[model samples]
Target: MGQTLYPAGCVLDRTGKPVTGFAGMGCEMSSEAIVRAPGAFVPGARYAQHRAEGANQVFVDVDAYGEFYHDYSPDHPMTMMRDRDNRLARLSLGMTHYQLVMGSENATAWSAGVVHYSHGTAQAHVSIVWKVKNDKDRFGGWWPSDRLPLFFKTFTPTEDEARLLFGAADRLPLFDAVFHDSVIASDRWEFGLMKVSGMEGARFARALLYGTPTIWPLDRQEVRRTGPWLKAAHDDFRIAHGWNAPVALTGFRWETADRLVQTTSFADGRTLTANFSSTPFQGLATHCVRVKRPEKAAIDLCPPALPTR
Candidate 1:
């Protein structure tokens, strides 16, 4: 399991006063301005002076990858450059000595060199308010039902959120351009093939567009239910870009106003085009993923459409 270690210090505002929380930090505020003063610590009284004064190490799990920043503690200052170098050194050591395939949670541009692939790169992180409104049983425990709940499968983002999360207009294929040859990028495992519900078509389309490998949860029953769809998607991807073909994502553009198309160029002079349009494309009944490879006829992968709203 991958982990990120952050140095402990009190987060400070622009005026150098320690902020209580992350709210209203704004673009001007720097998290790196955190100080190691005793008054700055949260729950200041609980931690003794000796313990707080000692080297502060905060460990974050793979699921909640923490941000990397400079630590301004005069005693043991950790700069951004130092942190990155440390991470790179560690990753290099692991790969070289252990012959391990290194992966992480989120694929930041800087870490792309050492890390092989990353999950949770594409996800609509629901706000706390939305979570509370939607998932009543989240805080209070509830018995598991025979079938998965709608909350687990479906999510509807607001217009701004949708544009930020799902719209292809503002996105660039820079990551694929740089690391597509070596890495197998993917979505979060929690939102895998059998997990996502209403916006399944959009997720699949995004995967094809980004040339990312599909993430599948390790649930036997769920796999039994949705295995065929997953297999077919994989098969289409595998056939288009051969098992060992030197493939590169060549082009991505808006085919139509609502339609996003991605073209993958293979080393063998063949190209694969994946055209994704919102469900009911040209009055079609289902959400469709249109894929065409050189010399082969175009095939549409249409699944039963669901209400995204």
Candidate 2:
């Protein structure tokens, strides 16, 4: 998992000491997890709550990304996850994505972080945690098939922010909006997943992390399901007997789209029988996105960039 220090410029850590370097990069490839250290350190309080809710929180800073496409390499899929259940009190926003990727070609250490999102608030692997130490650490390699599928992210930004940025945002490069959970967990303290989408956008970004070429076919379709507990928790967060917070869990469903590949776009009304691939806050993110967003697979397998333990 990649990680970095937050606040843009060099900063101090909790120890009151200057951070050793511009940023640190880490990858738990086996588990498909990435964590980067940010300039600003996240408060211990936030980390504590993240541990409680079972939300994946790292001491690293993270950035978000999008997709781009081309021939021989159409699109790659990515998955994202975040702390959407209000597990941590430090961030009091509307489950927005985080890690805006302040600087791409500028940072001395460059940008370091995990890319790809699930658009999901709590789905694990959907918010893909690359850099996993072993096979058990990950759900499995993200590919597309009726038996197995991948997920990646996509989002629709509001007009105001787009105007202020003076750009419509890159279809490939991902900004650390309020939604990227990796950033929220650390409070911009440490962790980085910096890099823009190549010709394939987020798809190519996935190629960078997975260390292999991802192939997205045609229609980009998905299906999703929710755990009973998660359904129970989201509807009534106030119920005492209910889960202390929304918990990340796994479920399955049949899916179809103009494409039949992995994706990070999200929808709430999804059911076990409905079709879905990713979440909203994080959008369609999963290693599978590269594989899922299309209807057919050519059997071209790509390897991870820094496959690690």
Best by TM-score: 1
Which candidate number maximizes lDDT?
1
Model 1 TM-score on a 0 to 1 scale: 0.62
* TM-score for each predicted model, relative to the true structure: 0.62, 0.17
lDDT of 1 by residue, 1-309 (tens): 011112234433335444343335522122333223334432122223324556232211241143544544444456666645655655544445444556677666666666566776555443533453345343221235544443234345456655655555556666676667766667665456544334566666566556677776545665666666677668756654557833666655555564455445544455444445444544332334555665777666554333333
The clash tally of candidate 2 reads: 139
- Count of backbone clashes, every candidate in sequence: 0, 139
Overall lDDT per candidate, in order of appearance: 0.51, 0.24
Q: lDDT per residue, candidate 2, 21-95, as tens digits?
A: 322533112101111233333433444555566665332222221211111111211132222111121222112
Model 2 regions more than 4 Å off? 1-138, 145-227, 240-309
